[model samples]
Target: MSATPADRIQLTGLRAQGRHGVYDFERARGQEFVVDAVLELDLTPAARTDDVADTVHYGELAERLVAVVAGEPVDLIETLADRLLAVCLADPRVDVATVTVHKPEAPVPHTFSDVAVTMTRRRAR
Candidate 1:
């Protein structure tokens, strides 16, 4: 028999406050960071079994991201975005991952809006 198909799951707009920046002021006074993640995985087994183990648990995923962001100080959002992608791809169930990190209180000379870095990665077939 042919295998069933998988489904796409997305976790969006997970907000967290972290101190990550190249400037001392930014590091001293932490700022809000926004994360949006999209996880593509095979949900057939999980759906049939109705078990959390069979699928990617969003709680764990969010926790992992939190751990990474709060782990240490980083100079660039790009690095943070890269690390998050690595963490997501570590899960075997994940086929594709897109991570976006937003820095709202950036140290810009003039008044401006949020700055963010977004990247997409996929597991090797």
Candidate 2:
């Protein structure tokens, strides 16, 4: 069976504050973080049946991601991206997942735009 159009959903640019950085001050003060998630699945059953049970609930997914990102302190945005990808793939309905985390205020000595990490994961058959 092929995936329907509704099966794909994107949760974009979710803003949150978290304590993640290599520096002590960055960890103490925290900073703004943006998360973007792309979830892929088959939604035909949900659309035909008109039942929430047949589909992935994006609200719940977002909540879970938020909890994980906000709960733990990590030094690397790579770790955060990996964790978010794991969370997304945990749902059986999700076949492919992409997670992006952006740190606008990275404590780099030089002036720059921002630091961002992006990762893509696929569920193992």
Candidate 3:
């Protein structure tokens, strides 16, 4: 059987400051953006070889993801999430990648928890 989404590596709660929003104030005063990502890939190679080379190095992945959050300014978290998914799927081993971008400081008139965008992408065969 092929690797399914169930077989995954999850990275969560990565925080970064980014200027992303529709309003000018939001862009001027950057807010924290939290990210969560799930990568689906076959772990058997790594397991069998016990080699880091066979698997995704999460430290490297984290750095890349954080760079995206801090690199460019976008109007929507959805676009940010899409960019993250692109990063996640850059590896040939990864079959699917799911990313969520959280904006805790979203401008809202009422009390709320958070606003976020989630996106998933699958590699082509």
Candidate 4:
């Protein structure tokens, strides 16, 4: 059997304040955006060698993700998710990236727990 997507690094609840919405008030004041990402990569090399270089550095990855979220102003969470996917895929070793962007403060008529967008991308061969 082939390796499953279970081989991955997961990061959750990554919060960053950003201006990402269609509403003018949202862009002006900004709101908290949460991120959850799963970086798919083989862990065998790192496990065998016991070396940091053999695997993805999650700390740096988190920082890079934060930069993307807090940097530019996008109109939709889908686009934000795409930008985040790019960041994960930037590491050649990452075979796939599954990301979710959550907006808890979305303007809605009714009470809602959250609004989010999730996407999964595979590296091009």
How many clashes would you count in candidate 2? Answer: 0
Instruction: Order the candidate numbers by lDDT, best to worst.
Output: 4, 3, 2, 1
Per-residue CA lDDT of model 3 for 8-45, tens digit only, reads 99999999888888899988989899999999999989
Two-way lDDT contest, 3 vs 4, winner: 4
Clashing pairs in 1: none
Candidate 3 local distance difference test against the native: 0.90
Candidate 3 Cα errors over 4 Å, as ranges = none
Candidate 4 regions with alpha-carbon error over 4 angstroms: 1-3
Candidate 1 per-residue lDDT over residues 1-125, each given as its tens digit: 21223467677888888889999988898888889888777788888999999888999999999888877889999999999999999998788888999887888888888888999998887
lDDT of 4 at 31: 94
* Global local distance difference test of model 4: 0.92
lDDT of 4 by residue, 56-87 (tens): 99999999999999988999999999999999
> Model 2 segments beyond 4 Å from truth?
2-6
lDDT of 2 at 80: 93
lDDT (Cα, 0-100) at 98 in candidate 1 = 88
- Could you give the C-alpha RMSD of every candidate to the true structure, in order shown? 2.7, 1.8, 1.2, 1.6
Residue 24 in candidate 1, Cα distance off native in Å: 1.0
- State residue 71's C-alpha deviation in candidate 2, in Å: 1.2
Return the TM-score for each candidate structure: 0.88, 0.90, 0.95, 0.95
